[model samples]
Target chain A: MNAIEIKNLNKSYQNGLKALENINLSVKKGEIFALLGPNGAGKSTLINIICGITKKSSGQIRVFGRDNEADYKKTRSMIGLVPQEIATDSFERVINTLRFSRGLFNKPSSDRYLDSVLNSLELSHKKSNQIRTLSGGMKRRVMIAKALSHEPNILFLDEPTAGVDVALRKTLWSYLNNLKKQGVTIFLTTHYIEEAENIADRIGVINNGKIIIIEYKKKLLKKFGEKKLIFTINRKNKSINTINSIIKKYELKQKGNKITFNYTQNSKKDPASDLLSELNKRSIRFQDLEIKKNNLEEIFINLVQK
Target chain B: MNIRGIKAIYNFEMSRTFRTITQSIASPVLSTILYFIVFGSAIGSRINDIDGLNYSSFLVPGLVMLTILNQSISNSSFGIYFPKFSGTIYEILSAPISPFEITCGYVLAAASKSVLVGIIILATSSFFIELSIIHPFWMIFLLILISLTFSLFGFIIGIWADDFQKIQLIPSFIITPLTFLGGSFYSINMLPEFWQKVSYFNPIVYLVSAFRWSFYGNSDVNIKISIFAIFFFLGLCLVLISMIFRSGYKIKT
Candidate 1:
């Protein structure tokens, strides 16, 4: 069964701003789905609506084939959310807060499970310490622990690394991977392209409240990433108009003496060698050449720009 | 139905109160004691009797009711507003718990603290004043009712307020001044007819009068009207809170 399915989702704020329009998505069980977007691109709104923290203007959302609203307790119990903010200010000990969060779902007390969560998150040593005294990173971990305490099968981390340091980001990356290894389905939203590129099995690009692209990470990379060959020919008496016309059919860019042409690597034929041979036939000499492929960052920018 | 959810929230809020015991409980009780010192001792000498009760003794119910109003609104408002400000309210909103369950947890904890402080001040006031009670059951009922009602009102204020300064706005500007003029320290009969009629407009006057009536079996207004006034405010607060949850005001989206 799919972990979550949202169809025809629409959210219009009372101020007449339409935050999301016609969003449909299906996240498979045990797969890490990354919703990539710019700020205010409806990423947080989508997650909030799914978790029932915000109301949707209209939509159908089902978790594991059951209506999300109809079975709020059952659906919410199956999911956990780590919000974007480091909002843990409860003056209680870390362990008590975790226990209390677990009990909020009516889960029976199990010290073993609690200890393991604490230990995995490296929070066991601070179990007895009050939450207000902990550092920022530790407080974020406690937020994650609170989300995990109830043992939800699906976890949503909203911009988990927004303001965190690189070291803590790495730690969280590995921790999330470990959770995925244990067969938990994870859904995370991030504005960082590399973050989604590194951890997501599937990446969905959202722009201006619309899902512009959603595909397997590898497929998206293969489709969007194309190789480009640029020739830095010696500045000479070559007719610029002729050169441009010669390569008019090929997707190309020209700046001074350097001319670049892009070709799909997966294409049946190599366009670079043909272009080079074509240049040679025209007696156009090149001083140097280099090949470039569209990285995930480039692809992300192109998609968002569109 | 969300008993576990209610317990977790209740426990968390209650622990916070315990942690800030000096601020939440001690400060107000200590302040009430100072009021007892100045008003009870210094003022009692000038006016020996009012409403057929000694001035010092007459101040008991009024002082307790005043403490209840101040602390109940302050505690409950700060309790809920802090979570909203820190963004931890998302946890409560996202949980499987219903809005009613959340209300029960926060409002009950606030009421408990205010009522506890009220009782403690009354205990402290007994050492200085010669106390008398005509209707003990009625007194206890009025005490619990006021705390619960005002705590709920504070909850509404907490939700309505979005900023740090706004949390203190109602309590400092509206409540404190109204309580002072609500016949807490003196009988309205001592005021001229115009001022007495003005005192009747203050909602807190009904609470203090009914509480004093339980002690001396004498009230400025009819006792039934006082009970009705409390319930009326309680119902209004409850309705406002219910609307807040139902419409997701300042909370959901």
Candidate 2:
């Protein structure tokens, strides 16, 4: 069974503003799904609704074949959420807070499991220290530890790396990788395409409360990634006629002494090597040669812009 | 239904009380003692007695009630408001715990703290003034009742308020003033007949009168009426709390 299934989800505010319009998506078990969106996108609203923090205007959400509202207790018990905000009671000691949260779910007190969670997050040493005394990164990790203290099967990270330093971000990346290996399905929403590109098995793009596209990361790259070849020719005006011919043949663009060609990986052999040989025969002595493929950011921009 | 959920929330809230011992317990206890020193002794030396009781002794129940009212409102309001301000409330909202359980956890913790503060203030008053609660059972009942009621009120104010200033506005401007004028320091009989009727409009007057009656077996208001007022306010606060949760007020997304 899929870890989560959402159907025809719609959320409209009291002011008659539609925050989510018929959002339908599913996350496979033991797979990492990254939801990429802009600032005002409905990423958070959808996550919050699934987590039972926000009510849906009209929709059906099922986790493990159980209706979210009908079996809220069982559903909530199986999922953990790492919110985007760094929120913890400053004065309370870290260990005590985690224990209390574990108890909240009516889970039996298992210090062994709690300790393992803390150790995994690198927070075991600071367990007895007050949360306020910890740095921002530590506190964020504590939030993660608290969420995991209950030992849920599925975890939802709502912009987990937001405002985090590079080091913590890398740590969190490996830690999440470990969770995925343990068969924990991860549903992540993030603005950082690089983070998603690094971790997400499948990418879902949402824009203005609509799910624009959802596809495998590799497939998305293969389909939308535009490969570019550029060369700098010393003599621009001399090569104008040859450059025009190449532009017509390969659909390239020229700016000053630079010529750019776009191609796909679908072609056999090297698509740009023949063009390179052609340029050599024409005596366009270009020293600077570069090949660039469109990153996830470009793909994301192209999808959202379209 | 989720008793463990309620317990977790309750214990977490109560831990904050011990963590900030000075702010939560000591400050109020010390202030209550100072109230006795200034109002009980300094003013007692001038006026002989009121309602056939020593002035210092007569202030005991009123002072205890005053502390409970302030403590109950302040504790519960801050208990919920701090989480909302810091954004930790999302965890509670997302949990399997129902809204009723959430309210039970926070309101119970706040009430218990207020009750403890009331008991401590009562013990403190006994040091300087010779006292006897003629109806000890009634006194305990009223203490718990007032604490629970005001704590719920504080919870409402916490959810109603959107910012720091508003959290403190009602308790300072409305509750404290009403308590002071509700015959905390003196009998309402000292005022004219019209003022006595005006004092009846304040809910604190009924609480103080009922509590004072349990102390001396005499009160400005009838015992039955006082009991009715407490239950009435308690019922209203409970309904308001349920409505607040249903409406998904400031706490929900």
Candidate 3:
């Protein structure tokens, strides 16, 4: 069964600003789905709607095949949400926060489970300490502990590492990957494209309250991925017009003594190979040749710009 | 019926109360004793008795009701408002617990705090004045009922308020004045005939009169009318809270 299914979901604020538009999405069980978007792109709004924090203007949502609104208790019980803000009771003890969250979900008291969650997050030592006394990164980990306290089947993290240092962010990514291995479906939104590249099984890009694209990490990379072939020409004696034909045909760019050609990596035509031979046939000599593959960050920028 | 969910919020609020014990318990107890020393001696000297009851003894029930009313409203309001201000309310809203369960948790915790304070005030007053309860059962019943009602009312205020000042606004400006004018230190009979009629319009008058009757077996308002007034207010608070939850007002949105 799908971990989450949202269809025809639309949300608009009272001021008539549309927050989400016809959002149709599904996250498979036990897979990590990362939503990538710039600020004000409705990524958090969508997650909040699914977690039952923000009321949807109109929509249908199902968690494990049950309508989320109609069966809120069942749906919400199956999900754990780590919100974007690190908002916690400052004076509350770490262990007590976990206990409170676990109890709020109506789960039976299980010190064993709570203790394990604390240990896994490296917060066992700080369990008795007040939340305010913890470092910023540790406090964030505490938020994760609270979300996991209920032992939910699905987890939603909104900008989980927005302000963490690189090393701590990597640790969080590893922890999330471990949860995914445990058969927990993980859904998250992030501004860091590499975060998604490293951990997400599937990636969805949203912009202006609309989902621009959603695809598997490998497939999305192959589909939009581009390769650039650059040739430094020894055009000392050859007519510049001789290379104009190749430039016009392959839509290449010429700068000084170098000509550049761009094409998708997965395309049927091997434009790089064809252009190399054409350069030889035309007697357009070259000193050096280099090929480069565009990364996900470039593709994301291209997609959002489009 | 998320009993554990209710218990979680209840424990959380109660722990906060204990954490600020000086403010929650000590401050009120001190104020109640001061009221006795000052009013019991200063005003007790001026007014000897009212309707055959010693002036100092007569202040007990009204004083208890005053503490319950103010503490109940402030405790519950601050309980819910702090979560909103700190942004932790998102966790509660997203949890599996229903609105009814959430209400029960906060209101019960607030009422429990106020009731405890009320009892302590009564005990302390006994040291200074010869306090008696003609109907201990009714006194206890009225104490709980009043606490629950005002706590629920304060819950509404917490939801309605956007800033910290607004949370204190209603309890300070509305509740405290009504209690003072409702015969907390003096019976409404001391007022002229027209002023007595005006005092009956204040809901706190009904609460204090019934509470006083439980202690002295005498009251300015009919016992049945006071009881009905309390239930009516309780119903009003419940309806307002239900509407707030249903509409996803300040808390959910």
Candidate 4:
């Protein structure tokens, strides 16, 4: 059974705003699932509902095959959340906060474990310092430490690296990957395509309060991901016009001095070879040729636009 | 609902609350001194005794209760409000901690502060006035009960308020006016018959009268009625706070 099963979830605020609608998703145990969306795509709302932080208007949500509402305590004990916004009480010390968070989960107080979590997040040195004294990046790490203190089975990181610097972001990603290796299911929501592309086993794109698609990362890329081939000519030969004519014959777009050919894996014909043959036949000389595969960002934009 | 969780939250909140020792202890002491000097020495001396106790002595219980009520309200309200304002409430809300545990921790912390402030003011008043404890146990009990009651009220206010200004509104608009009119400075008998009847409606009057009864063994209102009023208000606050937690009011939605 999936670690988390959400079926036909719906949520609407009291203000009559529909935050999520008809969403369905199932996350396998120990898999990194990346939920991607724009600013108002309801990613946080979905996470909030599953964590029991927010009430859902309609849905069937199960954690570890147990109904969330029926076994709320057990479900809550199994999950840890690192919110998108940094949320450590400014007056709290790092170590004490983590200890309290662990206790909140009814976990036995283990100073050694708390130390390890703080050390893992590089917060041990500042453990005694008040949270208000820390910089933004440090505070972010403190949040991670607090979440991991309880040693939950499933962890949700909502934009964990949103405003963090590059080095810290990479460090956090590495730490999160290590947590995933420990048999913890990770649900991450991020606007960073590279972060998802590197770590996510499965990707779910949400837009307009709906799940646009959910598929294996590689499979989704192979199916909907497009590739573009661009050629820069050595000279403005008359054959360039012939090349444009050939591309037009195949329903491609061409502008002054450049032509772009877009294709997917299931194209009727191999556009690359066809274009090369056409260029060869026309004696079109080119200085350089490049083929670029579409990234997740482009795919996300395309899906959202559609 | 979870005992261990409540304990943990309580410990954490209490420790943080007491971290700033000077501000937590000294500020309230200074404020109480000013109150005794201005109200007790100046205004209180000119005013005749009520219920056979000197004006300064009469003001002691009320002043102590005032400190408890004010500090209790501010501490809890600020405890929750600061987290909400700084976005740290999201962290706690997202954690495995239940809302009940969260409420218990914050309210306990606020109550602890109120108790501390109450004790400090009581000790300070000993220097200026002949402060006596007619029933030490009852005095302690009433102090704690009043502190807990107000702290819970403050917790509800904290959850209901969205911003800092809103948090302060409770103390400024509601708590202060109720306290002043509740016979903190004067007895209800000093007021006209119509106003005296109206004074009984304010809840703070009960707390003040009960606390004074414990201190001086005399009260303007019936001791049993004051006790009932306090416990009833406490129950009401608890019920409302529990409902807010169960419904996942502002904290979740």
Candidates' TM-scores?
A: 0.90, 0.92, 0.97, 0.91
**Taking the tens digit of each residue's C-alpha lDDT, what string does model 3 give over A1-306?**
899999999999999999999999999999999999999999999999999889999989999999989999999999999999999999999999999999999999898999999999899999999999999999999999999999999999999999999999999999999999999999999999999999999999999999999999999988998989988988574677877877899999988877888987555777778888888888888899899888889989999999
Off by over 4 Å in 2: A229-246, A254-259, A267-291
Model 1 clash pairs? Answer: none
Q: How good is model 4 by TM-score?
A: 0.91
Rank ordering of all candidates by TM-score, starting from the highest: 3, 2, 4, 1
Task: Report how closely model 3 matches the true complex, as a DockQ value.
Answer: 0.88
Error of 2 at A274 (Å): 8.7
Docking class of 2: medium
Candidate 3 residue A8 Cα shift, in angstroms, is: 0.4
**lDDT (C-alpha, whole model) for all candidates:** 0.88, 0.90, 0.93, 0.86
Q: Which has the higher lDDT value, candidate number 2 or candidate number 4? A: 2
For model 4, the local distance difference test gives: 0.86
| Each model's iRMS | 1.1, 1.1, 0.7, 2.0
Ranking of models by DockQ? 3, 2, 1, 4
Model 3 CAPRI rating: high
C-alpha DockQ for predicted model 2? 0.61
Candidate 1 versus truth, CA RMSD in Å, comes to: 3.6
What TM-score does chain A reach in every model? 0.89, 0.93, 0.95, 0.94
What does candidate 2's lDDT look like per residue over B43-143, in tens digits?
77787788999889889988898889989998899888988899988888778788889899999999999989988888888898887999999999999
User: Highest DockQ among the candidates is held by which one?
Assistant: 3
Off by over 4 Å in 3: A234-241, A281-285
What's model 2's TM-score?
0.92
